[model samples]
Target: SQQGEEDPQALSIQEGENATMNCSYKTSINNLQWYRQNSGRGLVHLILIRSNEREKHSGRLRVTLDTSKKSSSLLITASRAADTASYFCATVVNTIQGAQKLVFGQGTRLTINP
Candidate 1:
Protein backbone atom coordinates (compact mmCIF):
# COMPACT_ATOMS: atom_id res chain seq x y z
CA SER A 1 0.00 0.00 0.00
CA GLN A 2 1.12 3.54 -0.70
CA GLN A 3 2.13 5.34 2.44
CA GLY A 4 2.59 8.91 1.27
CA GLU A 5 -0.05 11.53 0.49
CA GLU A 6 0.89 15.00 -0.66
CA ASP A 7 -1.01 18.07 0.50
CA PRO A 8 -2.51 20.71 -1.78
CA GLN A 9 -3.60 18.71 -4.77
CA ALA A 10 -2.68 21.67 -6.93
CA LEU A 11 -0.65 24.83 -6.66
CA SER A 12 -0.23 27.83 -8.95
CA ILE A 13 2.47 30.43 -8.60
CA GLN A 14 4.00 33.18 -10.68
CA GLU A 15 7.49 32.85 -11.97
CA GLY A 16 10.19 33.83 -9.46
CA GLU A 17 7.92 32.98 -6.55
CA ASN A 18 8.50 30.14 -4.18
CA ALA A 19 6.46 26.97 -4.20
CA THR A 20 6.01 24.57 -1.34
CA MET A 21 4.41 21.14 -1.21
CA ASN A 22 3.98 18.75 1.68
CA CYS A 23 3.65 15.00 2.12
CA SER A 24 2.64 12.76 4.95
CA TYR A 25 3.23 9.09 5.41
CA LYS A 26 1.84 6.47 7.75
CA THR A 27 4.64 3.99 8.30
CA SER A 28 8.29 3.88 9.23
CA ILE A 29 10.56 4.46 6.28
CA ASN A 30 14.20 3.93 5.51
CA ASN A 31 14.36 7.00 3.34
CA LEU A 32 12.20 9.42 1.40
CA GLN A 33 12.62 10.71 -2.12
CA TRP A 34 11.05 13.45 -4.18
CA TYR A 35 10.39 13.23 -7.88
CA ARG A 36 9.17 15.50 -10.64
CA GLN A 37 7.31 14.52 -13.76
CA ASN A 38 6.66 16.72 -16.71
CA SER A 39 3.71 16.18 -19.02
CA GLY A 40 3.98 12.81 -20.72
CA ARG A 41 7.45 12.13 -19.39
CA GLY A 42 9.18 9.89 -16.91
CA LEU A 43 9.72 10.83 -13.30
CA VAL A 44 12.94 12.63 -12.54
CA HIS A 45 14.56 11.99 -9.19
CA LEU A 46 14.92 15.22 -7.28
CA ILE A 47 16.43 14.40 -3.92
CA LEU A 48 16.50 11.72 -1.27
CA ILE A 49 16.78 12.14 2.48
CA ARG A 50 17.62 9.25 4.70
CA SER A 51 15.79 8.55 7.91
CA ASN A 52 18.72 9.99 9.78
CA GLU A 53 18.67 13.16 7.78
CA ARG A 54 16.58 16.11 8.77
CA GLU A 55 17.05 18.25 5.68
CA LYS A 56 18.60 18.22 2.26
CA HIS A 57 19.02 20.66 -0.60
CA SER A 58 19.95 20.61 -4.25
CA GLY A 59 20.08 23.75 -6.30
CA ARG A 60 16.73 25.52 -5.96
CA LEU A 61 15.11 22.59 -4.16
CA ARG A 62 15.06 22.16 -0.41
CA VAL A 63 13.56 19.19 1.40
CA THR A 64 12.89 18.66 5.05
CA LEU A 65 11.82 15.44 6.70
CA ASP A 66 10.31 15.06 10.13
CA THR A 67 10.19 11.39 10.99
CA SER A 68 8.57 12.15 14.30
CA LYS A 69 5.59 13.52 12.47
CA LYS A 70 5.88 11.20 9.51
CA SER A 71 5.87 14.13 7.16
CA SER A 72 8.07 15.94 4.69
CA SER A 73 8.01 19.17 2.74
CA LEU A 74 9.60 20.32 -0.47
CA LEU A 75 10.37 23.91 -1.27
CA ILE A 76 11.26 25.29 -4.64
CA THR A 77 12.84 28.70 -4.61
CA ALA A 78 12.77 31.08 -7.53
CA SER A 79 10.19 29.08 -9.35
CA ARG A 80 10.13 29.26 -13.14
CA ALA A 81 7.64 28.26 -15.79
CA ALA A 82 9.78 25.25 -16.53
CA ASP A 83 9.30 24.18 -12.95
CA THR A 84 5.64 23.54 -13.58
CA ALA A 85 5.04 19.83 -13.21
CA SER A 86 3.72 17.08 -11.01
CA TYR A 87 5.70 16.41 -7.85
CA PHE A 88 5.55 13.22 -5.88
CA CYS A 89 7.00 12.02 -2.62
CA ALA A 90 8.06 8.41 -2.26
CA THR A 91 8.95 6.42 0.81
CA VAL A 92 11.29 3.49 0.93
CA VAL A 93 10.38 0.69 3.24
CA ASN A 94 11.98 -2.63 3.96
CA THR A 95 9.74 -5.61 3.53
CA ILE A 96 9.98 -8.96 5.21
CA GLN A 97 11.47 -10.34 2.04
CA GLY A 98 14.58 -8.30 2.75
CA ALA A 99 13.92 -6.02 -0.16
CA GLN A 100 13.02 -2.38 -0.31
CA LYS A 101 9.76 -1.09 -1.70
CA LEU A 102 9.04 2.41 -2.90
CA VAL A 103 5.57 3.81 -2.41
CA PHE A 104 4.59 7.14 -3.90
CA GLY A 105 2.19 9.86 -2.85
CA GLN A 106 -0.76 11.01 -4.94
CA GLY A 107 1.23 14.05 -6.07
CA THR A 108 0.93 17.82 -6.21
CA ARG A 109 0.46 19.57 -9.52
CA LEU A 110 2.36 22.85 -9.59
CA THR A 111 1.78 25.48 -12.21
CA ILE A 112 4.32 28.26 -12.58
CA ASN A 113 2.92 31.08 -14.62
CA PRO A 114 5.19 33.28 -16.60
Candidate 2:
Protein backbone atom coordinates (compact mmCIF):
# COMPACT_ATOMS: atom_id res chain seq x y z
CA SER A 1 0.00 0.00 0.00
CA GLN A 2 1.74 3.11 -1.25
CA GLN A 3 -0.18 5.38 1.09
CA GLY A 4 0.64 8.53 3.01
CA GLU A 5 0.00 9.49 6.63
CA GLU A 6 -1.02 12.82 8.12
CA ASP A 7 0.59 14.18 11.21
CA PRO A 8 -1.36 14.95 14.42
CA GLN A 9 -3.88 12.20 14.90
CA ALA A 10 -6.17 14.82 16.45
CA LEU A 11 -6.57 18.60 16.57
CA SER A 12 -8.70 21.07 18.53
CA ILE A 13 -9.81 24.50 17.45
CA GLN A 14 -12.29 27.16 18.43
CA GLU A 15 -15.10 28.56 16.40
CA GLY A 16 -13.93 31.27 14.00
CA GLU A 17 -10.38 29.96 14.16
CA ASN A 18 -8.21 28.20 11.62
CA ALA A 19 -6.82 24.69 11.23
CA THR A 20 -3.91 23.16 9.37
CA MET A 21 -2.83 19.59 8.56
CA ASN A 22 0.11 17.92 6.87
CA CYS A 23 0.50 14.77 4.80
CA SER A 24 3.59 12.83 3.70
CA TYR A 25 3.53 10.03 1.14
CA LYS A 26 5.80 7.16 0.25
CA THR A 27 6.13 6.94 -3.58
CA SER A 28 5.31 8.76 -6.78
CA ILE A 29 1.65 9.48 -7.46
CA ASN A 30 -0.45 11.00 -10.22
CA ASN A 31 -2.60 13.25 -8.05
CA LEU A 32 -3.56 13.88 -4.46
CA GLN A 33 -6.88 14.99 -3.02
CA TRP A 34 -8.08 16.12 0.32
CA TYR A 35 -11.35 15.04 1.88
CA ARG A 36 -13.41 15.82 4.93
CA GLN A 37 -15.40 13.45 7.15
CA ASN A 38 -17.96 14.31 9.74
CA SER A 39 -18.16 12.37 12.99
CA GLY A 40 -15.96 9.64 11.56
CA ARG A 41 -18.48 9.04 8.81
CA GLY A 42 -18.99 9.97 5.16
CA LEU A 43 -16.17 11.57 3.21
CA VAL A 44 -16.68 14.56 0.92
CA HIS A 45 -14.14 15.83 -1.59
CA LEU A 46 -12.70 19.09 -0.42
CA ILE A 47 -9.92 19.86 -2.90
CA LEU A 48 -7.66 18.25 -5.49
CA ILE A 49 -4.33 19.39 -6.95
CA ARG A 50 -2.34 17.47 -9.49
CA SER A 51 1.41 16.82 -9.73
CA ASN A 52 1.97 19.60 -12.23
CA GLU A 53 0.46 22.19 -9.95
CA ARG A 54 1.99 23.81 -6.90
CA GLU A 55 -0.84 25.52 -5.06
CA LYS A 56 -4.60 25.94 -5.38
CA HIS A 57 -7.30 27.68 -3.42
CA SER A 58 -11.06 27.48 -3.18
CA GLY A 59 -13.14 29.83 -1.09
CA ARG A 60 -11.82 29.37 2.42
CA LEU A 61 -9.58 26.42 1.59
CA ARG A 62 -5.96 26.57 0.48
CA VAL A 63 -3.76 23.65 -0.58
CA THR A 64 -0.05 23.43 -1.33
CA LEU A 65 1.94 20.58 -2.82
CA ASP A 66 5.68 19.91 -2.91
CA THR A 67 6.42 17.03 -5.25
CA SER A 68 10.13 17.09 -4.49
CA LYS A 69 9.36 16.34 -0.85
CA LYS A 70 6.33 14.14 -1.64
CA SER A 71 4.17 16.02 0.81
CA SER A 72 1.21 18.44 1.02
CA SER A 73 -0.54 20.80 3.35
CA LEU A 74 -4.08 22.11 3.82
CA LEU A 75 -5.24 25.27 5.53
CA ILE A 76 -8.78 26.23 6.42
CA THR A 77 -9.53 29.75 7.47
CA ALA A 78 -12.13 31.22 9.83
CA SER A 79 -13.40 27.83 10.90
CA ARG A 80 -16.73 27.29 12.52
CA ALA A 81 -17.87 24.78 15.09
CA ALA A 82 -19.51 22.88 12.29
CA ASP A 83 -16.04 22.71 10.75
CA THR A 84 -15.18 20.05 13.28
CA ALA A 85 -14.36 17.02 11.20
CA SER A 86 -11.61 14.64 10.21
CA TYR A 87 -9.47 15.50 7.19
CA PHE A 88 -7.79 12.90 5.00
CA CYS A 89 -5.37 12.90 2.09
CA ALA A 90 -6.03 10.46 -0.76
CA THR A 91 -3.80 9.48 -3.65
CA VAL A 92 -4.76 8.40 -7.16
CA VAL A 93 -2.47 6.05 -9.03
CA ASN A 94 -2.48 3.53 -11.83
CA THR A 95 -2.96 -0.08 -10.92
CA ILE A 96 -2.50 -3.42 -12.61
CA GLN A 97 -6.25 -3.39 -13.10
CA GLY A 98 -5.90 -0.32 -15.36
CA ALA A 99 -7.94 1.93 -13.08
CA GLN A 100 -7.17 4.23 -10.18
CA LYS A 101 -8.49 4.21 -6.63
CA LEU A 102 -8.55 6.65 -3.73
CA VAL A 103 -6.47 5.38 -0.82
CA PHE A 104 -7.08 7.05 2.53
CA GLY A 105 -5.01 7.67 5.62
CA GLN A 106 -6.06 7.47 9.27
CA GLY A 107 -6.97 11.20 9.05
CA THR A 108 -6.49 14.16 11.34
CA ARG A 109 -9.38 14.82 13.69
CA LEU A 110 -10.32 18.51 13.96
CA THR A 111 -12.49 19.62 16.82
CA ILE A 112 -14.03 23.08 16.91
CA ASN A 113 -15.27 24.33 20.25
CA PRO A 114 -18.27 26.59 20.12
Candidate 3:
Protein backbone atom coordinates (compact mmCIF):
# COMPACT_ATOMS: atom_id res chain seq x y z
CA SER A 1 0.00 0.00 0.00
CA GLN A 2 1.10 3.55 -0.64
CA GLN A 3 -0.17 4.75 2.73
CA GLY A 4 2.60 5.55 5.17
CA GLU A 5 2.45 4.33 8.77
CA GLU A 6 2.35 6.91 11.52
CA ASP A 7 2.94 5.84 15.09
CA PRO A 8 1.48 7.08 18.37
CA GLN A 9 -2.12 6.75 17.28
CA ALA A 10 -2.87 9.20 20.08
CA LEU A 11 -0.77 11.73 21.91
CA SER A 12 -1.51 13.98 24.88
CA ILE A 13 0.80 16.79 25.91
CA GLN A 14 0.74 19.87 28.05
CA GLU A 15 1.12 23.36 26.73
CA GLY A 16 4.68 24.52 26.03
CA GLU A 17 5.75 20.92 25.56
CA ASN A 18 7.07 19.34 22.41
CA ALA A 19 5.29 16.80 20.22
CA THR A 20 7.03 14.34 17.98
CA MET A 21 5.53 11.95 15.41
CA ASN A 22 7.04 9.36 13.11
CA CYS A 23 6.04 7.93 9.76
CA SER A 24 7.34 4.93 7.83
CA TYR A 25 6.56 4.02 4.28
CA LYS A 26 6.95 0.84 2.24
CA THR A 27 7.40 2.08 -1.32
CA SER A 28 9.32 4.65 -3.26
CA ILE A 29 7.65 8.00 -3.37
CA ASN A 30 8.16 11.28 -5.08
CA ASN A 31 7.54 13.22 -1.91
CA LEU A 32 6.06 13.05 1.56
CA GLN A 33 3.64 15.66 2.86
CA TRP A 34 2.54 16.36 6.39
CA TYR A 35 -0.94 17.72 6.91
CA ARG A 36 -2.88 18.72 9.98
CA GLN A 37 -6.62 18.38 10.49
CA ASN A 38 -8.37 20.29 13.22
CA SER A 39 -11.38 18.67 14.80
CA GLY A 40 -13.48 17.73 11.77
CA ARG A 41 -11.99 20.45 9.61
CA GLY A 42 -10.20 20.07 6.33
CA LEU A 43 -6.48 19.36 6.34
CA VAL A 44 -3.92 22.12 6.12
CA HIS A 45 -0.65 21.41 4.45
CA LEU A 46 2.11 21.67 6.99
CA ILE A 47 5.09 20.80 4.84
CA LEU A 48 6.31 18.72 1.95
CA ILE A 49 9.81 17.33 1.48
CA ARG A 50 10.84 15.72 -1.72
CA SER A 51 12.69 12.41 -1.71
CA ASN A 52 15.92 14.25 -2.39
CA GLU A 53 15.54 16.61 0.51
CA ARG A 54 16.94 15.50 3.82
CA GLU A 55 15.29 17.97 6.17
CA LYS A 56 12.91 20.93 6.21
CA HIS A 57 11.71 23.38 8.78
CA SER A 58 8.69 25.66 8.98
CA GLY A 59 8.00 27.85 11.95
CA ARG A 60 7.63 25.56 14.99
CA LEU A 61 7.71 22.44 12.84
CA ARG A 62 10.83 20.46 12.06
CA VAL A 63 10.85 17.56 9.65
CA THR A 64 13.66 15.12 8.96
CA LEU A 65 13.75 12.58 6.18
CA ASP A 66 15.88 9.45 6.15
CA THR A 67 15.55 7.76 2.83
CA SER A 68 17.89 4.96 3.84
CA LYS A 69 15.40 3.92 6.49
CA LYS A 70 12.35 4.94 4.49
CA SER A 71 11.08 6.98 7.38
CA SER A 72 10.49 10.55 8.51
CA SER A 73 9.93 12.42 11.74
CA LEU A 74 8.07 15.61 12.56
CA LEU A 75 8.79 17.62 15.67
CA ILE A 76 6.62 20.40 16.97
CA THR A 77 8.34 22.65 19.44
CA ALA A 78 6.61 24.76 22.06
CA SER A 79 3.26 23.19 21.63
CA ARG A 80 -0.09 24.57 22.69
CA ALA A 81 -3.74 23.57 22.87
CA ALA A 82 -4.16 25.24 19.50
CA ASP A 83 -1.78 22.64 18.15
CA THR A 84 -4.18 19.85 18.99
CA ALA A 85 -5.09 18.07 15.80
CA SER A 86 -4.74 14.94 13.73
CA TYR A 87 -1.52 14.71 11.75
CA PHE A 88 -1.28 12.58 8.66
CA CYS A 89 1.75 11.83 6.49
CA ALA A 90 0.70 11.41 2.90
CA THR A 91 3.03 9.82 0.37
CA VAL A 92 3.01 11.02 -3.19
CA VAL A 93 3.18 7.93 -5.38
CA ASN A 94 3.72 7.98 -9.07
CA THR A 95 1.17 5.94 -10.96
CA ILE A 96 0.69 4.82 -14.52
CA GLN A 97 -1.91 7.52 -14.95
CA GLY A 98 1.02 9.99 -14.99
CA ALA A 99 -0.38 11.55 -11.88
CA GLN A 100 1.13 11.61 -8.45
CA LYS A 101 -1.38 10.82 -5.72
CA LEU A 102 -1.20 11.22 -2.00
CA VAL A 103 -2.09 8.27 0.24
CA PHE A 104 -2.92 9.22 3.79
CA GLY A 105 -2.16 7.11 6.80
CA GLN A 106 -4.54 6.56 9.70
CA GLY A 107 -3.04 9.64 11.41
CA THR A 108 -1.98 10.53 14.93
CA ARG A 109 -4.49 12.39 17.05
CA LEU A 110 -2.61 14.83 19.24
CA THR A 111 -4.31 16.59 22.14
CA ILE A 112 -2.77 19.42 24.06
CA ASN A 113 -3.62 19.39 27.75
CA PRO A 114 -4.41 22.81 29.01
Candidate 4:
Protein backbone atom coordinates (compact mmCIF):
# COMPACT_ATOMS: atom_id res chain seq x y z
CA SER A 1 0.00 0.00 0.00
CA GLN A 2 1.02 3.58 -0.54
CA GLN A 3 -0.07 4.49 2.98
CA GLY A 4 2.59 5.74 5.38
CA GLU A 5 3.18 3.99 8.69
CA GLU A 6 4.28 5.96 11.70
CA ASP A 7 6.99 4.57 13.95
CA PRO A 8 6.56 4.24 17.72
CA GLN A 9 2.81 3.73 17.63
CA ALA A 10 2.57 5.42 21.02
CA LEU A 11 4.68 8.05 22.72
CA SER A 12 4.68 9.66 26.15
CA ILE A 13 6.57 12.65 27.43
CA GLN A 14 6.37 15.31 30.11
CA GLU A 15 4.90 18.69 29.42
CA GLY A 16 7.43 21.24 28.12
CA GLU A 17 9.48 18.44 26.56
CA ASN A 18 9.89 17.84 22.87
CA ALA A 19 8.18 14.96 21.08
CA THR A 20 9.23 13.40 17.80
CA MET A 21 7.53 10.91 15.48
CA ASN A 22 8.58 9.24 12.28
CA CYS A 23 6.64 7.90 9.30
CA SER A 24 7.63 5.79 6.30
CA TYR A 25 5.77 5.14 3.08
CA LYS A 26 6.14 2.78 0.11
CA THR A 27 5.23 4.85 -2.96
CA SER A 28 5.97 8.16 -4.60
CA ILE A 29 3.76 11.10 -3.67
CA ASN A 30 3.06 14.66 -4.60
CA ASN A 31 2.96 15.89 -1.02
CA LEU A 32 2.64 14.71 2.57
CA GLN A 33 0.32 16.27 5.13
CA TRP A 34 0.32 15.89 8.89
CA TYR A 35 -2.87 15.91 10.90
CA ARG A 36 -3.62 15.86 14.60
CA GLN A 37 -6.80 14.50 16.15
CA ASN A 38 -7.77 14.94 19.75
CA SER A 39 -9.55 12.09 21.43
CA GLY A 40 -13.01 11.73 19.89
CA ARG A 41 -12.44 14.68 17.63
CA GLY A 42 -11.94 15.38 13.96
CA LEU A 43 -8.50 15.78 12.44
CA VAL A 44 -6.80 19.15 12.34
CA HIS A 45 -4.31 19.78 9.56
CA LEU A 46 -0.83 20.53 10.81
CA ILE A 47 1.46 20.93 7.86
CA LEU A 48 2.20 19.84 4.32
CA ILE A 49 5.52 19.36 2.55
CA ARG A 50 5.84 18.95 -1.16
CA SER A 51 8.13 16.34 -2.69
CA ASN A 52 10.59 19.06 -3.65
CA GLU A 53 10.71 20.48 -0.15
CA ARG A 54 12.90 19.04 2.55
CA GLU A 55 11.50 20.72 5.62
CA LYS A 56 8.66 22.95 6.80
CA HIS A 57 7.69 24.53 10.06
CA SER A 58 4.54 25.95 11.66
CA GLY A 59 4.58 27.60 15.06
CA ARG A 60 6.02 25.03 17.47
CA LEU A 61 5.90 22.18 14.95
CA ARG A 62 8.59 21.11 12.51
CA VAL A 63 8.29 18.52 9.76
CA THR A 64 11.00 17.01 7.61
CA LEU A 65 10.53 14.98 4.46
CA ASP A 66 13.07 12.72 2.79
CA THR A 67 11.77 11.57 -0.52
CA SER A 68 14.90 9.52 -1.16
CA LYS A 69 14.08 7.33 1.82
CA LYS A 70 10.31 7.59 1.51
CA SER A 71 10.15 8.79 5.09
CA SER A 72 9.10 11.82 7.10
CA SER A 73 9.35 13.03 10.66
CA LEU A 74 7.34 15.39 12.84
CA LEU A 75 8.74 17.28 15.81
CA ILE A 76 6.71 19.06 18.43
CA THR A 77 8.80 21.33 20.57
CA ALA A 78 7.83 22.26 24.12
CA SER A 79 4.81 20.03 24.17
CA ARG A 80 1.89 20.73 26.46
CA ALA A 81 -0.68 18.46 28.02
CA ALA A 82 -3.25 19.82 25.63
CA ASP A 83 -1.08 18.56 22.78
CA THR A 84 -1.91 14.96 23.55
CA ALA A 85 -3.46 13.55 20.41
CA SER A 86 -3.12 11.08 17.54
CA TYR A 87 -0.93 12.25 14.72
CA PHE A 88 -1.31 10.98 11.18
CA CYS A 89 0.74 11.35 8.06
CA ALA A 90 -1.16 11.40 4.81
CA THR A 91 0.39 11.19 1.38
CA VAL A 92 -1.16 12.64 -1.74
CA VAL A 93 -0.69 10.45 -4.81
CA ASN A 94 -1.85 11.15 -8.32
CA THR A 95 -3.87 8.49 -10.07
CA ILE A 96 -3.90 7.67 -13.76
CA GLN A 97 -7.28 9.34 -14.05
CA GLY A 98 -5.77 12.62 -12.85
CA ALA A 99 -7.26 12.47 -9.41
CA GLN A 100 -5.30 12.97 -6.21
CA LYS A 101 -5.86 10.46 -3.45
CA LEU A 102 -4.85 11.00 0.16
CA VAL A 103 -3.66 7.91 2.00
CA PHE A 104 -3.22 8.14 5.76
CA GLY A 105 -1.02 6.18 8.11
CA GLN A 106 -2.24 4.21 11.08
CA GLY A 107 -1.22 7.13 13.31
CA THR A 108 1.00 7.74 16.32
CA ARG A 109 -0.71 8.43 19.62
CA LEU A 110 1.10 11.05 21.68
CA THR A 111 0.59 11.72 25.34
CA ILE A 112 1.98 14.73 27.13
CA ASN A 113 2.06 14.32 30.87
CA PRO A 114 1.66 17.30 33.10
What are the clash counts of all predictions, listed in order? Answer: 0, 0, 0, 0
**Candidate topping lDDT:** 1
TM-scores of the candidates in the order shown:
0.95, 0.93, 0.95, 0.95
Q: Write the per-residue lDDT of candidate 4 for residues 1-114, one digit (tens) a residue.
A: 647899889999999999999999989888999999999999999999999999999999999999999999999999999999999999987779998888989999999999
Model 1 lDDT-worst window of ten: 92-101
Best-to-worst order by TM-score is 1, 3, 4, 2
lDDT of each: 0.96, 0.89, 0.92, 0.94
Indicate the worst ten consecutive residues by lDDT in candidate 3: 1-10
After the best TM-score superposition of candidate 1, give how far the Cα of residue 45 lies from its true spot, in angstroms: 0.4
Error of 4 at 12 (Å): 0.5
Better of 1 and 4 by lDDT: 1
The residue-by-residue lDDT of candidate 3 on 1-114, one tens digit each, is 646999989999999999999999988877899999999799999999999999999999999999899999999999989999999999987879998778888899999999
| Top candidate (TM-score) | 1
Candidate 4 lDDT (Cα, 0 to 1) = 0.94
Query: Could you tell me the C-alpha RMSD of candidate 2 in Å?
Result: 1.3
- lDDT tens readout by residue for model 2, 1-114: 548799788999888888989998877878889999998578899999999999999999999999999999999999988889899999986679998888777799999898
Write down the worst ten-residue block by lDDT for model 4. Answer: 1-10
- The alpha-carbon lDDT assigned to residue 61 of candidate 3 equals 99
